[model samples]
Target: MRMGGLTVWFWALASASALLLGPVVSSSSTTWVADGTVLELDDSNFESAISSLDLVLVDFHAPWCGHCKRLAPQLDAAAPMLAALKNPIVIAKVNADKYSSLRDKYGVDGFPTLKLFIHGVPQDYKGPRNADLLVRYLKKFAAPDVTVLDSDSAVADFVEAAGTFFPIYIGFGLEESVVSKLALKYKRKAWFSVVKDVSEDVMMLYDFDKVPALVSLHPSYNEQHVFYGPFEEEFLEDFIKQSLLPLAMPINYDTLKSLDDDERKLVLTIVEDEDDEKSKNLIKILKSAASANRDLIFGYVGLKQWEDFADTFGANKKTKLPKMVVWDRTEEYFRVNGSETIGEEDQASQVSQFLEGYKEGRTIKERVGGSLSLTSFISSFLGLGTVYVLVFVVATIILVRKATEEEPLRVGRGDEVDRATSSISEAESREAGEKED
Candidate 1:
């Protein structure tokens, strides 16, 4: 049975190749046709062959399709195997560009549309043009039942009926970040009715340091939210509500800012030993909490391989190791010794209490008063103004003194004539007076 099945399969493939290659042209005693040959189908012989065949496999192809080029050789190899089939199928070719009418008639939009026709009736086929897939489709449905439609028109028709609710979520590689899991969870909840490839575009847009970047788009609006680590279920639920639904609580940061009497709370905690596992875990939890909620400002000073990370938190030789500080824009401050073992829950609770009391007091800087001290500012301004005034006064005095200095006069022809005339007049007067005497 297996041998018989193999024989049938081989025969089917050969038939497919012969039909796919081109129409067979007969020459002599053995009736040699152009089987297993990739050739052109022109207007001259097309019509008569279409009239003769019960099943005509017309490949509407272009030279540019890589898949079509690949399909050509495979079609050639299958030609001889096809000759053994009881009811033989013939291969034909149509260059869609040259035969524009044929393409227009079939409504062919994309290249290499394979159409199987029987008795001039069209039926069912859609594709990526894989030969094996095509063979299976033919075997299951038979050649006559499959119809070919124009790629563009067929896509348009399907899209119209495809339905609403398109949701697209984009994320980074799962191995790179924990955010990938959150992104996938969101994708499943939203429904895969609509999906898009946003990998390249999102990576550039966000200047994303890391991913999984989750972006969801609906008919009404689009939402993008980013997560870096393990996200709590409740927090994620709230995020979706805030992002998608209009009636949702504003995220925690907004609520903190709205308080009329908000104080900047600062807390400091010190850990004695740097190499302790408890200290590292506490730091991790604190950082995670700070990342998730901006309610309390958290800073860490570590002394475990402390030299390596010392530069990161601005810690130096003078500063003590295993120190944690909580600072609110600067009204209230608290310090704790880090030589102790403090769990994540304890740290969270302590920080939360500190902020609550701190905000109630409102000892922090107000917008107007926080800029600078009035006395210092005035003194600084006056000092600069005094320096400028002295500079101007010195420049003016020098300019006046320079202007008052004597300047040498140039001897011109007019001055010479005046001097000479006065001298002559005096001499004449003296001579006249002497004569009168």
Candidate 2:
């Protein structure tokens, strides 16, 4: 039998056996620890307990909140390390909804509010996230180290320490974004933090979520202010007082409009559904392409405003729902139907090809290789598995047959028949001798 056939037979038998008893043998379980046993803090124990405990960390949580759910596992894993610390702190959790009095006492407004208390009182606190800063704060004032904290703790303290000259970065949306790019370019020094989801206390403190939000953390608040919005390099260059600053400023829409006809390129896309998965994917690809090349201008016109964009581009929407129109500075634009008709598995491949062709100013040859497509690969794998089982069965049958047909050896002594034959020969010899006499 062939090697492939024997292998296939063994594999098929093993798989069928595994499938028969899989559910009966496998199991998964989760242990839920009693909250009150592990967590030791209550309204009655709060005052006396806080003073005695060296470090007190309280998590004010709710049943709902997706972010809270994601954070819980991390916090739980850290509990043991916290417990092992010298003059260790007690970690406690509180459901704000269940314990309204405690919530009121702490002024808890957020879904998850982590508070660190020193000597039965809430010390100047910051967290729920930002674990590093929290750890540092706890180690400095709350722990036995007696180490002094950073100069910028409170809002007033930050303003006081930041003196006259400071660094500033301006950008829209996520504050944690690359505002520092322009700041580092000019070599302007400043403090920076992006605002995503802020608390009520924080909102009241900042006053407004200002666009072109100028964020500066320096002693010279008056000298540096960052405006977060779409901006031109010329404006940025003119605005900078010092020539020492390096800039990573992005090109604005106006700059692209001023470019020569040959150098300019614009991609206009009509997204019928903003929330659709296909639309999201197209947007992601476009954004990446736009970031990589400055000459490639990318813009999205929502299908929500399809008529306005279609009329302007003279786009044919009868056949295509998600259409793309590309143009130079001329009135006429090259157009294509909705990104290979939506449900394409290789949307990224298609988009990559589209953009590369557009950038070269002429249609490019296909770079995508058909090196054993997915379907063929899967079919080949299954065929090999089948061959292995057949080989295994043939090997097993041969082994069994060889075992059954094997000849057994036997041991024997000289028997009666041999003795009789010898006696008869002697008798015949004696008779022959008498007859001759």
Candidate 3:
């Protein structure tokens, strides 16, 4: 079978089996707001609390936004649990309608934007809004990035019991942490565990001799790959990429060179960071996309690492990661717009549409910046308004000062004229008296 066909088949099977699980996980809760848990905030406490708190989850919402209204109660219920995390996170809400300053500052374009302030830097929360999920996600910020499998039972249950359905990334023996960073990086994609202090009996169960070894076990895909350290972050990433993509392959230097010059169009995702939610989720979404469309070759390229490759199509300059594009192997690439650079959860429909257009021999072009046009227009308008206001104010101030100074000068001139007139009248009277004598 063709590479694209193989990719499509593999992902479809994984998703159908629930190995690639649906993203959303939800729960129930009561109507509540900052009851010793959540904080009711305006401009006043927003900055101070976010800056002061070790970790905080701030909801930027407009009153009229339906999503914001729906999310309110669940957020309120999740507040206490989130606050009760190890580092004790603070949950705060801002009415974006009342405080446009905060919303605009944070780049909150949507109605309900969840910004998680970790040490004062705001990060968008990409997980589910369900109270339980929110609490779990918030709790991760407080907990250790990697959880060590302490017991033989813990290792068995977490690793062996994960079966082939879930991707279990195991960091075996001598875990001062060679791959801990990688484990954390792939947290959204895989279950990661480190065992630095494993008993000899438990260690023998896996039958690996290396002091620091990393293994990926996936039962659903029936795959097992092990790598012995010195494990760097890059090595760990490459390892996982090779393992998960049994049918669908990762886009890299060697892979890019290997693309057949046939009629197959390459769907490449420009990813900057593996740790980012957008990049990771986009990869997952593409896996499903590959499953559906067996004819199209779908893969991702890391924009940060592969500057030369990104420069080929000017993708390197794009500040955003997880941007999709379609290449026809004709020295040009057409960007695919599924929903604004990995923000949408359901990208399968849009991706499929792009593929259908290609199949029908339609000329699919790159997405030009409507965003750029709109921003430039708004900026130009604001710039003009500021200049007009400043000019008007300056002119008014100059006019007022000129009038005040002129009034004092006019009064002095009038006094001089009166004195001269009195002297002239005295001189004429003296001459007349001399003539009469």
Candidate 4:
């Protein structure tokens, strides 16, 4: 998934790789500093510090935020180790609450927002929060954009050192110059390596039969796609873009935001619970469909896991579970005319029919969160603010009506309306409280 232009996948991949390959070791021969300190910055020095550094990871945080407080010591612990790199990444933080103008300039909407600045250009830091993982993640930035693999051992070592956090592209029997430009272009997204020496075992391992093959490996997903390319800039870039996402992604806030770069609409499956046996079986079916229909992104969300988010797609406790829809990831979605729900029997056939119907335009288009406005789009996140605004508007209307009334209102009807509004307000308040917790 792409997080602020930096594509990331499951962190579980990194954890598993650590277990199998052990800790990552730097190959730099230069002597490094053993002690380094995190820099404290404010509006006065923030610009100067970022502009002067080749690489800087800045934390925009509020002092009182619980998450920010927890992250402080981790950054402190990581500072010295990160500073010891050949191309050291300086760690810094600003009290965003105290410097509201600086916070607004950087568009820091939430506490503990970490941004990595590469020569003053900022990209969001969405990697691990733990000290060791953070240090390992930052080390990737300092490595060469494209590494040349000379031997079988080098290939094995490169893959092992890469871990599973980023996708790896190894060009077999291809020139370094051919992929050098792309390697630089997508440096933040994936690792690129050109293998000059090709072996039979390496060929079998990567599952490619020919030379001039570019293999894209998502180690996290244990998935790989081979491109026997014309290798032109456009075609190569297209392959790289498509390779960024997995075949079947689980829907959540981070994954949803990742779709911003991909133009393909989502084939979203909504289930009662995503972790259950039935959902797992259905995901296998979805993955099969995804392999064939690469133009559409296949994703699944559990209603039980994220009720508020699922409700945006017209799902609720009363709605039938395991529903499918084609979502544009914005305000509108499409529902197949007759195949709104998926059945337990012949599930694969049902999915095939739904896709066929959608492609044939035998579906109903519907808008989500009312009219297409920025406010409505933003309200789709949680929607508690929208609820409060609606409640206030209704209360204002009732007050205006009562003040303008010249005669006594009907007592029973007035009490019923008051009770109804009160109940709605109370229920919304409770929900908002729960969300804060």
Candidate 5:
């Protein structure tokens, strides 16, 4: 009996020792501990850091990149604010230039590439770069999928807290269950809330006339859309999808990619400059048109901001300013026969006419390569300079063929060849003058 008791005591002592030392061993192995500072990571610890954290924002950047240098201060300032939240999000970075394998693995093509990792899943970060904006943007990921608002003040507070980055959806006189699934479905794209107790003033504020209404607000654009219906899953989803983007969206590389799943044709407006007063006025007119025509996407791009992209639409320094076209967001685009350009005078009327002509099928279909064209593929593989050279060669060949076909009998005569070349140059100049006019 004495021997058996001693054996049991020894086993008990061993169990106590393990209980005391197990946590220390685990803590020593943990290389990443969330303490409110930006963590510098490399290949050795990058996987372990991201895999252990629930949410992480990784900046793949190079030391010599000017933009990366500018962004470092912002991340440093926002790290502590984010880490103080109930659900902390780790801010981390990897020197992509030094770590070539890590850079290629994540497809880090540009400097200061921000990517958010949620439960080990990677997504491109498209939010603002400012310190305060970064904090507000990252907080969304840490927040609840569906926030509950009881009073009018809570609703206002929720809207204020959501900021102007993502669309806000508030469900009034509706059960949380109705939008819970949708909130989870589009948690990354929008902010969802349920207002249990609503006031008459609140209803009037949101411009909703009836109960069981879903008010979707694009605060950045000062636009609101209300849906009052059976609230079936399909109908609700349709409304949510439509409210994801504002009426007048600025066309850029990122915004273009965001429209991949949207089936609507884009009524693209190319302007001299998007930030100028004239362009701003044109955008207002386009937004008014967009309000009436929700089936189409109204977008505007600036010639100076993205000349290369505008070149794809036949818009260049020589072409008339404020040109309009209907693009299918792919290979084919449609140009209205009569309303091709919006004049400075009677601009609203011109836009209306363009829309009417487009709807009446008074359009000419033209094929053009988009971002996924062979030219872009070559540019990506062999650099943009090569694409420019290829385009120049093709244009020269076409011009030569036209000149030869026009004067076949004078091909052997040097004087005739010189005259043909002069004629071709004059024709090109005239074409450019016509485009300018």
Candidate 6:
């Protein structure tokens, strides 16, 4: 133990500490592996609990992971608060060592993997592990309490007031009607208000024609979108859920920046002509995809308005039209659909594949377009042209020098040419004299 220069006592103390703070499992009733408000889960009950509870947060952990031991108490403290919400949630913990298949099924690659199971669908939890944050995050799934505003002026003031929640639904009818029921159903996602026997002016102010009408007002845009209805529960529920999101929100400077800041992938549909059939279809296609992907942010940019913004992402009307892309901030990657044209089925499939690939570190990134791309292309062309031009000029100068230089024999040199001419004249004179003789 003391063979090295330093001591080895830290190991013994750490071992003892782990043993002291470790999970306790007993034959009779000593302690469940997960203590306090958390429920101890096994393979048998894991699926049943998730399917039974409308909202259940599952913690996949092992006894040896240091983070799990630390998170145990935090989750235990947050459990009661979660259960106290309108749509209560159960906090369950599974010992991954005992239930290997369950852990693998849920893709628990790391220690203390937290997954929020909503109606039996599992989604990875990315929020902080602290008790307060866990409590608040889980409580958002529960139906929010409805608040009633007094007087017409009060309604106006309240509607005009600034808040984080958007499209605050104000019901102008009785509390016991279908509106309250709808409010209760969707309260977790949206804010709700009830005005007891409100006036016609109030309804008209919010763009509602009759009593029991539902008015959704957006304070940021200072405009109201009205929904007068059959008021059936199904219709109202569907309307609230879908109406909460604008089908294809235009991606502008603020929205593009926001997309970069967001944790999830931003699926932007760049459509040039908003009135074109292709553009119109994108709204529905994107809406369906958004419905399937509630975790990811969905947006669209018009080719006319936000063309510059789209250009940054390498999408323009001429080359890549009506396409879909997922910008992964974490990986710094971009994946476009394989098909050139955007089809509803193809977009959904490609997006699904991108999401799946992203988890496994398989997303491939390409260059984002700007002046840089054009500069690179021009540089490449000029670089090749410079090489060829240099070769041509060098070859021409070499040929010209070879043709104009003095010859070695009596050909082009000044003295050699004069001597050759004189020798020819003398030979000709001697031949003429001999003929005369």
Top candidate by TM-score: 4
Which stretch of 10 consecutive residues in model 3 shows the poorest summed lDDT?
A: 16-25
Cα deviation at 327, candidate 6, in Å, is: 12
How well is each residue in 1-437 modelled by candidate 1, as lDDT tens digits? Answer: 32333333232222212222234433232232434343355566555555444445677765545545677765554433333233445555687646766765665533456676653344323322444444432332222111122333442342332222222333343331333344444432232111123245545553445544433333222333554434465664445433332111111222222221333232333443433786656555554454444444444434433332332223345554444434343332333332222434566665444445444653332221223332222222222222223344443454355544232111112222232233233334555666679
Give the range of the ten consecutive residues with the poorest summed lDDT in model 4. 4-13
- Residue range 1-437, candidate 2, lDDT tens digits: 12333333233233322001111122133222222123645565555445555456777766554445666765665555455444444556777645667766675534466777754566323432444333423433322211122222343343443333333332323443344455444431233334444344543444435554433332321223354434455554434332112111112222222233224456656556545787767777666655455455666655454343344444344535455557553435664433433334665566666666565555322211123222222222222223234444554566456544332111111221222223233334445666679
**Model 4 bad stretches (over 4 Å):** 1-35, 369-437
For every candidate structure, what is the RMSD over all alpha carbons to the true structure, in angstroms? 35.2, 29.5, 25.3, 12.3, 19.2, 29.1
Candidate 6 global CA lDDT score = 0.57
Worst 10 residues of 1 by lDDT: 245-254
For candidate 6, lDDT tens digit of each residue in 143-248?
4456677789878766654243455787777464656776666654566777776877886667767777777765544445566776778877756665565544
Compute each candidate's TM-score over C-alphas: 0.25, 0.26, 0.46, 0.76, 0.73, 0.40
**Comparing 1 and 4 on TM-score, the stronger one:** 4
Ranking by TM-score: 4, 5, 3, 6, 2, 1
| lDDT: the better of candidates 3 and 4 | 4
Q: Tell me the spans in candidate 5 whose CA falls farther than 4 Å from its real position.
A: 1-28, 272-282, 302-308, 343-353, 356-362, 367-437
Clashes of 2: 36
In model 5, the worst 10-residue window by lDDT is 16-25
lDDT of 5 by residue, 301-395 (tens): 99988776777787888889899999986557999999878899999999999999999999999876543355553333333234444555454
